[model samples]
Target: MTMRSILKSWVERYFSDEEALILLVVLVAGFAAIIWFGRMLAPFFTALVLAFLLQGVVSALTRRRVPHLLAVIMVFLAFVSVLLTLAFILMPLIWNQLVGLVQETPRMFASGQGWLDQLQERFPNIVTPDQMQSWIGVAGREISQLGQRALTLSLTSLGNVMSLIIYLVLVPILVFFMLKDREALVGFTLSLLPQKRTLLTRIWHEMDRQIANYIRGKSIEIVIVGTVAYITFAFFGLPYTALLAVLVGFSVLVPYIGAAVATIPVAAVAGFHFGISEQFVYVLVAYGVLQALDGNVLAPVLFSETNNIHPVSIIVAVLFFGGIWGFWGVFFAIPLATLLKALVYAWPRGLEGRQTSQVPPLKQD
Candidate 1:
C-alpha cells in the first residue's frame, strides 16, 4: 500500500469508531486543561481527589444504611480534625525541629571541617592543604547559600500564610459539597456525554476503584511510615526527628526516589551530631530497618497490586509531571500514568473487524 493509503487505513482502523474518536477528544481536552490551568485549579483538583479518597469510607457507611448526609458529615469531620491536627500540632513540632536544625548549622560545619582537617594532617599527600582549603571553600559557599535560601524562604512563608489559609478554608468546603453531591455530579457528567459509552464506562469502572484504593492506601502509608521514622529517630536521640520524619513519610509518594532522597538528611544529621559513635550506627541501623519494612512489608500490604506501574515509567512520570506541576504533579504521577495506560489499551478499534465478521462467508456451490 502507498504511504497515503497506509495513513488512511490506520485512521479508519481506529478513529472511524465514534466511541474511540470521542474518547480521544475528551482525553486530549482533559490533558490540555490540566497542563494549562494546573496551578490555578489546584484547590479544586485537590478537593476532588480528597472527596474521591473519602468516597470509599462514605460508601461503606452508606452500605450499612447510614444516612448519606450523616456519612458525609462524619467523614468531613474526620478530615477536618486530621487537617487541624497536622496544621496546629504536627506542623508546629516540625517547625521547631527545623529551627533547631538551622541553628545547628554552624556546629555541623565545624564538625565536618574538623574531620576534614584531621584527615589532612593524618594523610598529608592524599589530603593536601591546598585541596582541603579548596574543598572547605566550596563547602562554605554552599552552606552560605543554603542559609540565605532558608532565610528567604522563611520570609516568603509569611506571604504564603495567606494562600495556605485560603486552601485550608476552600478545600474542605469544596470537598464537603463534592462528597454530598457526588451522585448528582456524576449523573450530570454522564448527561454531557453520549449514552452509548461502553469504552468510557469500562475505563471509569477500572480507574475509579484503582484510584480510590491508591489515594487511601498512600495516605495510610505516609502516616505509618512517618510515625515509624519519628519513633525510631527519637529513640536513637537523633536531631530534627519531626522534620526528618515528615520528609521520610512523604517520600513514599515517589517510590524509589523519595526513600533515597530522605536518607541524606537523616544520615547527615546523625553523622554531624555523633561523629562515628555507636549512637550514629544505631540510628543508621534503625533508619535502614524502617525503610526496609516500608518497601518490603508495609507497601505490599497497603498498596497491594493497585499501582502496578513499571519502575521506569514511574520515574519518568515523576520527572515529567514534577517539572510541569511541581510537588502535586510528582505525587499524582503514577496514577496519571496508569490512567494514560488504561486509555491507550482500552481504546476501541475501528468497525473494520466487526464489519468483516458480519459479512457472510463465500458460499461453496
Candidate 2:
C-alpha cells in the first residue's frame, strides 16, 4: 500500500471505535486540568485522596447496619482525632528531635572530620590533606546552609500558619462533605458523560478497585513499617528515633529507591552514636529485618495482586512524576502507572476489522 493508503488504514483501525476517541479526549482534558490548575487544586485533590482513604472505613461501618450519615460522621470524627493527636503529640516530639539533630550538627561534623584525618594518615597519597580539607569545607558549607534554611523555615512558619490553618479547616470539611454526598456526587459526575459508556464503566470499575486496594495497602504498610522502625530504633537507643521512624515510613513510598535512600540517615545516626560497635550492627540487622519482612511478608499480604505494573514502569513513573510533583507524585506513581497500563490495554483496537465485517468493501478506485 502507498503511504497515504497505509496512513488511512492505520487511522481507520484505531479510530473506528467512538469509545476510544471519547476516552482519549477525556484523558487529555483531565491531564490538561491537572497541569493547568495543579497548585490551585492541591487542596481539593488532597481532600479527594483523604476521602478515598477513609472511604473503606466508612463503608465498613455502614456494612454493619450503621446509618450512612452516622457512619460518615463517625469516620470523620475518628479522622479528626487522629489528626489532632498527631499535631499535638507526634508532631511536637518529631520537631523536638529535629531541633536536637540540628543542635548536634557541629559534633557530627567534628566526628566526621576526625575520621577523615585518620583515613588520610592511613592512605596519605590517596587522601591528601588539602583535598580532605577542601571536601570537608564543602560539606561544612552545605551543612551550614541546610541548618540555616531549616532554622529560617521554622522561624517563618508563623507566616505560613494561615495557610496551614486553611488547609486544616478546609480539607476535613471537603472530605466530610464528599463522604456524605458520595453517591450524589458520583451520579452528578456520571451524568455529564454519554449515556452509553461501556468502556468507561469498565475502566472506572477496574480503577476504583485497584486504587482502593493500593491506598489501603500503602496506608497499612506505612503504619507497620513506621511502627517497626520506631521500635527497633528505640530498642537500639538511637537518637531521633521518632523522626527517623517517620522518614523510614514515608520512604516506602518510592519502593526500591526509598528503602535505599532511607538507609543513609539511619546509618549516619548509628555511626555517629555507636561508631562500629555491636549495637550499631544490631541496629542495622534490625532495620534489615524490618525491610525484609515488609517486602517478603507485609507487602505480599497487603498488596497481593493489586498493582500489575512492571518494576521498570514503576521506577520510571516515580522518576517522571516525582520530578513534576515531588513527594505526592512519587507516592502515587505506581497507581498512576497502573492506570496508564490499563488504559493502553483497554483502548479499543481492530477498528478496521470491525468495519470490514459490518460493511461491504468498496471497489478499488
The top-ranked prediction according to lDDT is 2
Residue-level lDDT of model 1, residues 185-248, one tens digit each, is 9999999999877777888887887777778889999999999888888887877888998999
RMSD of each: 2.6, 3.8
State the lDDT at 29 in candidate 1. Answer: 92
TM-score of each: 0.91, 0.91
Candidate 1 lDDT score relative to the true structure: 0.87
The sequence of per-residue lDDT tens digits that candidate 2 reaches over residues 1-365 is: 79999999877666657877777789899878777888889889999999999999999999999999999999999999998888789999999999999889889889979988998999999978989999999999999998998899899997988888888899999999999999999999989888867778888888998889988899989999999899889988899999999999998899888999999889889989998789889888889989999989998898896856678888999999899887778888888898888877766433333455779778998
**Candidate 2: residue 111 lDDT (0-100):** 92
| Candidate 1 residue runs with Cα over 4 Å from true position | 120-132, 348-365
lDDT of each: 0.87, 0.88
